[model samples]
Target: MHQVHVVGLGVDHRDITPTASRLIDSAEVLAGGDRLLALFNDHPAVKILIKSPLKNVIDRINQEMQSHRKVVVLADGDPLFFGIGKRLIDAFGKDAVIIYPNVTTLQVAASKLKIPWHDIKSISLHGRKDIQPLLTALVGNNRVAVFTEPDFSPAKVADELIRRGADTFNMHVFEDLETETEKTRCFELKDAVKQTFSPLNFIILNRIKQAVISLSLGLDDDLYLHQRGLITKREIRVAGLSSLEIEPHHTLWDLGAGCGSVAIEASLLAYEGIVLAVEKAPERIQLIRQNISRMCAYGVEVIHGEMPECLESLPDPHRVFIGGGMGKDNSVLEAATERLRPGGKLVLHLVLMGSMARARDYLKDLKWPFSITQLQVSRSKDLAGDHRLEALNPVFIISAKKPALRL
Candidate 1:
């Protein structure tokens, strides 16, 4: 009959606005979570408790609407924001529902902390076990807010962040916001992982001032922990990374990721994306982990496995860097190119002329347009009282992009 009114009650019954209170008072049918429905125990309206298997709740609302003139659904915070209001709007046509908004829990959390949230990244872990997006956001953003779920609780989130070598953040947990039991506490990531919090909570992660890493592309080779000359040279890495054309949210693969230099640098560039570094050597894998922590590149993941084989299990890439498999077979290159997303870029670094020839022929056969650059870098070395330039080995850098449409 009449349009259903969905009201957002901030934290409790005390948060109901005058208009929401009037609507609830006159409602012939009221529906909400048990906690929300219980707040209006004195109301004479027929109350329906919102439950899981949400279809049942939708069914009840549909049935009640046939007999009632006024049906009101109660929601927490802003109804449209990760709330049931969207479900109602989708179930009924947009014209059949009217939504009344209120400040969201995230807004309150930010307000309580006196932090400006316009630029903060907000993620909802409710009913989601995937932590990748959260981790990605945490890597690139200085501030983030997360809505917690039972399975992916605040402590669990903290654990995941710490496990990924993210320790430079200060975590703020707001529990029972705006309610009698409201409690807010802030802790370092290490301490946050050890403490349990109320299920009704949100977490705020603010990166520490000193934890910010430089945005420059090529960091000094000496800054990373690597075996004797096993790392990608700074100039070569800079040239290769530039060719990769990394975007902020592009998933990248660093095959033969020696000390994860390319992946770590790409992670900084693609902070909102994931960089999978597949390295075969266990020693190098450890080194990659250490370098990732050193660079604060939380978005880079070090996979302790060989290339071509490890490529299958990874998410399809928007870009790939073949830095370590130069002298090896061309199968890794082929696999990486095939898995690249449409319009994706692939960059390869080769020290051997034969390897470069093989890669060039492979790209030619695939009909992929490509470019090659030879990098010859000379660095100044302190010798006795004079500085002499020492030439590093020349590297061949090849880059190609997968055509967006099949030829």
Candidate 2:
């Protein structure tokens, strides 16, 4: 079988290893981007330009392989490090592909700063639409390296961090790595957002200071920026989240999310997952954003629309929490329950006895096993310079799980 050789050209062409050079020399087909291909413009071989809708490139490579052509695919840095090597490996099994790795941009960038990179968390925003990965990367790590794309530039990344109030890190942007024109500059996230960078660039974020509020399973209600004490109490929030049985990768929908306290904490629990906080009120939507920013809850998405309607465009959820928006009828509850994934859990916080009865009846009609926990919390308050236990409004926690599919 003719094997395809994927070579990483490092930062400079002069650094190419002798073995990679020999493979490129013996190639009957050369595949890479226009910039990389320009290095071997004089070489007499069939050229395949790697372009968008990469399936075509894969097909052409497969066709050339059938003809027993020696194919050399040129790439930058380490081919397996967020490059095209995986695609080739997927197209043709690992046995059919030989990889020659060179020094990566991250290595060079870290070397210039004299910083050890093994501890650094690296993520690529290249050709990616969601910044959740980047946000999640910032959760525990003090340092993060990012491979930026043209559309999602360094400035855009800084802008996003600033928007989310997770901009505690200093931004280090490296431009044109390994070239004489290479330039590296460090900026505070606020300043980085206003600056432009070269197309060929990467960024590093180093946490400068601890966030004002340390995130945990349950945060005090006073820490959040809710309107008129409209946020979920800490006790009920924890209990409701526990009832959802959230996993690290579970997608959660906080329907009728008021002030977004539950959704914010849920995002922290489901670190690798997404949380959609659907709220119809504009004021509460703003409050949710403020709380998300304050808490540095990176994965919670504030969706400003009514339940059942907004739920249509969202992906199927692994956990559903209905805190409000049940309306005068049970339409929202019915809609949320029906949309829960098989074996997924649904939790609701209802203060009204009438609403709780309606929910019970709905679950009964569907023959779904459900449980309810009446949560009553009390906190001590100062009464005339002395502390006294003050009772909070009682809440009914209802939880149910959809049955898994049976063969």
Candidate 3:
């Protein structure tokens, strides 16, 4: 059987190489999206228009291949870079296909802007409902490039950035790249939010200004929007996170997340991981979202329902933090423990002795390795002409680890 040839068209028709031209000219059957196929309208090969329900297209390609026809698939840029080449390789193993590489849109965008793309984080917003990747990239990288889908435009991206208070970056929107009608424009997020562009566009975000909100592990309380006395103290948050022993890919849950302080900070530690902030109170849920944006705490999902019942729908956590949701009943604690993955860690913050006792007993029953830490934090206060240490409420942190599965 003849292997399928997947050719990348670079950024323009002129950019197609001699080798790729030879493959396209020799193909008995050609397959690609409408735009790519239009470039070769005069070609003699049978054209298969690639469209949604791509499974049909794959099946058709398979049928052609079985008939011993030479199939050529045209793709934009380097197909392996967020393009159809990977899907083809997955559909038919690597040995069954040959990919001809070319310059990607990211490379062209970088060249046009005269910026090095070596470190720029790239994500595609195509067919995506959540902008979590955008948010996450903005938090960690100085520059980000997005492959914009028709439905998820630059304006929508701007709106989300502005909403998250992560609008400190300058936006660059490239429309109809490499075509005769190609256009490039740059704007502040505020201005970008009000404008629209071609459906065929790419976005690059450059960090021009520092975020107004400070982002760090155990961020200052004043940086977050929360009701007075509702946020976790900075020191307690630090201690709790330390006890959770979060790894880069661990999924951590903040049960009864108040303004998402612990979860937001945990996101930094679990940078390549998932963090969920579960809050029951409507007002606090809003606050959690605001803090998530302000803090640039990407990947922290705000769950807006009560504990125990709400935790059921969530992915099992590798680390769990119980800050506020436990009532007189131990259902919340029980649920979190039951849902925790083996070798996972759970940490709880309590000011009340009764609550501490309940958590202690719960861990003891599970016979998990556990430890307690007493934290007494104080900040300096100006008394008259000088400063004095004003003590905050004492907090008890309980740390427990679920036993690993024995081999």
RMSD of each: 4.2, 3.0, 4.1
Give per-residue lDDT, candidate 3, residue 396. Answer: 88
Pitting candidate 2 against candidate 3, the one with the higher TM-score is 2
Residue-wise C-alpha lDDT for candidate 3, range 26-108, written one tens digit per residue:
99999999999998899999999998788999999999999999999999888899989988889999999899999999999
- Report clash pairs, candidate 2: none
For residue 357, model 2's alpha carbon misses the true position, in angstroms, by 1.9
lDDT of 3: 0.87
lDDT tens digits, residue span 1-407, model 2 = 86889999988777988899889998899999988999999999999999988999999999999998888999989999989999999989999989999998889999989999999999998778878788888877889999998878989989888877786689999999888889999999889989978998988899887766787878888888877757779998999988998999998998888888898888888888888889999988888887776666767888898766878888889999988835888878888877889999989898989889988898989888899999999999989999999999899998998988898
Q: Model 3, poorest ten-residue lDDT window? A: 290-299
Stretches of candidate 3 exceeding 4 Å from the true structure: 41-67, 90-95, 219-230, 249-251, 280-294, 298-318, 334-345, 360-407
Candidate 1 global lDDT: 0.85
User: Which structure is stronger by lDDT: 1 or 2?
Assistant: 2
Ranking by lDDT: 2, 3, 1
Query: Which runs of model 2 end up more than 4 angstroms from their true locations?
Result: 227-229, 366-369, 376-394, 403-407
Which candidate wins on TM-score? 2
